[model samples]
Target: MKSNPNFLFPKLASTIEELRQLSISEERKKVLRPLVLYIQRCVQESKTCNLNFICTHNSRRSQFGQIWAKVASEYFGISANCFSGGMEVTAFNERAVESLKRSGFKISSKGKGNPIYAVSFSENSDPIVCFSKLYDDRVNHVENFAAVMTCDHAEENCPFIPGAEVRIPLHYKDPKEFDGTDLEEKKYDERSMQIASEMFHVFSEAEKQG
Candidate 1:
């Protein structure tokens, strides 16, 4: 990975440390380590790595993966691109946006009828481009990218991704089950934070190796 003189290593390290304090399953740690190491290899080789996080609804887990990947890439001084899509077309959920905002992401909504939300990692960084679309449509022409399955349904249903060099399954539980309860928002926020924290931890380890 190319080194940046302005890279904020201390801040990134602290962020990862804080995130690691949150709970993560042992099963998840196993999958996350290899996946992150793969990303580190791609970055080290100076390959233009493109990542697609897939799910059934393209609303929750996949979205979180996409955002966290982008943020982690920036944090590690890696140049990588991240995208997310689902098997079915669905608008971005408001709860997801709110959860990200609560976790230090800046989100701006524009357009109409479930408009695409522009998400930025930090105030000065370029915003990550986000929209609701099917996985195939989103990655129709892209080749040589990593396809990460963030939901079990998507991973099982779509066995083959035409252009993906590496296919990794990183399933996450849907927080939607807790919707409409007193813990609805809290659950969503917790889910978002969990994804963010784990991703941060994984990338921080990769950075250390470099």
Candidate 2:
């Protein structure tokens, strides 16, 4: 894997390499094509790439997707902005936070409920600011961005995102089911890796088009 001084941990780089090997099904790949096209058009037009990943809760899959999308975009030398939101606000779940820490992102938090998280992938790079909020929150892009639905419920409910020029249903299985089970930590980590791989696919392909 290529070395990145911006990545805060050596493991982050290697884990991403491992994720690239995971098999993404043809069905999911087809669903992901629109997302790729959106990104390709943005790059070809020299426009800013804004991606908002949404789910029922911003706790798990969406958070992982947002962070990994930014990491992968940077890894591939693509300029992009990534954000995550939910239908309703909820804290970034501790389980998912721990999973990302294990994957080598340096994370810190402030505030109480729905606290803000500063997750850093590399030392010199600015950390990604993360918190749970509505998909239309003022902190995110208000228009001309792609809305990536990371869970089924959000996809079904948010059929239309007013200002989104493009919307993509790139759903994922919720790892929240394993919360209290013996496989809790294992499952959370698995889901994180899954999103990391797919986001890597998204941005890596975008880089090629650029």
Query: Measured by TM-score, how close is model 1 to the native structure?
Result: 0.87
Q: Largest lDDT belongs to which candidate?
A: 2
Instruction: List the global CA lDDT of all models.
Output: 0.77, 0.86
Q: Could you give candidate 1's per-residue lDDT for residues 19-112 as a string of tens digits?
A: 7688777887888877777777876787756788889988888888888877877867776788888888888887888887766666798887
Q: How close is candidate 2 to the true structure, as a TM-score?
A: 0.94
For model 1 the local lDDT of residue 63 reads 89
Off by over 4 Å in 1: 1-17, 23-26, 138-141
* C-alpha-based local distance difference test score of model 1: 0.77
RMSD of 2: 2.0
Highest TM-score: which candidate?
A: 2
Worst 10 residues of 2 by lDDT: 1-10
